[model samples]
Target: MRPPTRLARAGGALLLAAALSGSLGGCLSAYLGTAPEENSPTAPPSAPPGPRTTAPTGAAAVTAAVTVTIGNFLFQPANFTVRPGGTVTVVNGDTVEHTLTAQDRTFGTPPIAPGASATFTAPAQRGDYAYLCTFHHFMRGILTVA
Candidate 1:
């Protein structure tokens, strides 16, 4: 068959452009809806794995401290207790960076790189303190001081 006329070619190009734009718009919306935010209160289903290390500082330097392990975007022993003003050591066993941040802003750790570790001191007050990973908010745990 003979090649299409110029008008036909232009029409075809416009149709293709429209289709691509629609698909791309849909993808952008999907990403914005699903991608996690820094202040998000939920965690993704999983995280990639890798290895890194960080030096323990502040309360983590204390020899006597309770251990909290992070893996699979979940905190081990999601609930635990410590003495008021006690030291708590956070071990990052996951392959991604994470944080143990108190909801009340009373205590929190720096971003603990994968396979790295950090520490924070428990609140001196007697009560339950809820915490979560600042990066992955869904990864949460409870710390009680009594």
Candidate 2:
């Protein structure tokens, strides 16, 4: 048989590329974290595992005046209330260290090691604030200043 023409070879390459792109698109959920730059080459084999999440059952919401717990890879009482400019303490119950990284830079804390505690002063704006563990950066929670 005659070898394929140059036009035929180009068409085959385009068909192969289309098929590969379609397959990769279906696996986007595996990369659920913050989307990086479009041309960045630092992606994982799968959607680099995300943080463990939990809904606030009000479990630690009332503990010892605005104290929350960080243990078992979750933020107990995923949300809590605080007075404007009041203190919000985080008590770490896990062996690993954690942080209360303010998403808005309103407040933050140094590392709170296992069985330790750290406090962040609530913003004075009477609004809800979001935060996460700088260490985990996925263990998220909220603080409401009213």
Candidate 3:
């Protein structure tokens, strides 16, 4: 058999390069997307940005710590509400990992390995917030504050 010609070798190299760049592009986007903007300075520490309030701890303390479990390719209690200024604890009940991501970029968790959990303060407002498991498109949920 004859050795590959220049054109063939160039084509192969181009294909390999394209494939690598496609995958690496994804990685770069993910990293850049999550990184804080270098040009945008953070807000003053004395003045907090969002309507951050302490999670209620009172007669509603028992209900204040809400839990959203992830398993079966689903967010158990796919829809639920909690009082404003409360805590939402996302528990990964599945054998595989999961993520609790807010569509509005208001909040989210890094990958929660199986049986692990992440907790964040609910938005201090009275409205509906939609979220999803970034890893699983079909896995979604709603958080309501009223």
Q: What is the per-residue lDDT of model 1 for residues 1-146, given as tens digits with 9 covering 90 to 100?
A: 99899999999999999999999989998887756666666855566886777544344443345899998889987987777888899999999999999988779999999999997888878788999988987888888776
Model 3 / residue 4 / CA error / Å: 71
| Error of model 3, residue 26, in angstroms | 60
List, residue by residue over 1-146, the lDDT tens digit for candidate 2. Answer: 99999999999999999998887766664666457666678854456678988645463433335778888989887888876677778899999999887898769889998999998778878677898888897799888776
Candidate 3 residue lDDT tens string, 1-146: 99999999999999999999999989998887755555657633354577868656454533566888887989888987777778988999899989878898787788999989998888887788999889897898888777
TM-score preference between candidates 2 and 3, better one: 3
lDDT of 1 at 96: 90
Clash count in backbone of candidate 3: 0
In candidate 1 the C-alpha lDDT for residue 92 amounts to 92
Candidate ordering by lDDT (highest first): 1, 3, 2
Off by over 4 Å in 3: 1-62
Clashes of 2: 2
